[model samples]
Target: MSEGKKMTSSRRLQLKSLMLQIATKRLEEEKKEVAAAKEAYIIENCPPPDLSGDMAALTEFCKKLHIAIDKIDEGRYDIEAKVQKINKEVRDKQQANCFKL
Candidate 1:
């Protein structure tokens, strides 16, 4: 069964855009919540700044943080490489078109 009233192309586009915006906002909220929870967990389990006495705990956290940061750095490099490849492909396509004219 179909509705008596059909939606126009513009209306469909508007609905899709609105849906995307709603999804993006929800994702942002979830990311913020996850970050807050992680921070809280770290504060509760990790030692305080006065680790001047228990250097062991400080050292462990440093090692853990270094590993996490290394992963982020690797991801950053991967994204940069992907972006450069995409741009090069686009430029190559454009140049190919120029040769035809």
Candidate 2:
């Protein structure tokens, strides 16, 4: 392999690695933001039912809270899957480039 070609390949790998690192950091920040938002939403909207001797009302509130929690979990899973997909694509691209050299 020529010297120039080797340098170019090395630079490309460095750039790819930097990009992957930045993307990973961004994904982590996004996940943290989502978690914060979910926590805030739960705090603001899912207050405990008043224990004023109303069994039916308390049960209904509990049911609603369960549903909300389930939805939040599903949304978080979906977001995580998307982040993983992006990470996988970056990894695949890096592998392909490595094989090219």
Candidate 3:
């Protein structure tokens, strides 16, 4: 490639890398928000009974919370995987272009 074309390609690659980093950071923040929301949901909707001795009910509440949290985590994991895959693709493309230059 010509010098101008190579410089442009390098700049484009840098932009892609920056964009991917921003997206990854945003996803991480979103995951944290989801976790906080799950915790809040559990607290708000499944308050412990006042019996002070009902271990069974407390355990059941905990179990339900665990299931909900797990589901949220699974969804976040899927999103993260997709972001990572896209990041990898961008990196691969950038590397290939670099080699061509």
What tens digits encode model 1's per-residue C-alpha lDDT throughout 1-101? 98699899999999999999999999999999999999999999975655554778889878878998999999999999999999999999999999999
- TM-score of each prediction: 0.49, 0.51, 0.45
Task: Give the Å shift of residue 88 in candidate 3.
Answer: 0.5
Q: How many clashing pairs per prediction, in order?
A: 0, 0, 0
Clashing pairs in 2: none
lDDT of 2: 0.92
lDDT of 3 at 95: 100
| Candidate achieving the largest TM-score | 2
Residue 101, candidate 1: Cα error in Å is 1.8
lDDT of each: 0.92, 0.92, 0.91
Ranking by TM-score: 2, 1, 3
TM-score of 2: 0.51
Give a tens-digit lDDT track for model 3, residues 6-68: 557889999999999999999999999999999999999988756564889878878877998
Off by over 4 Å in 3: 1-53
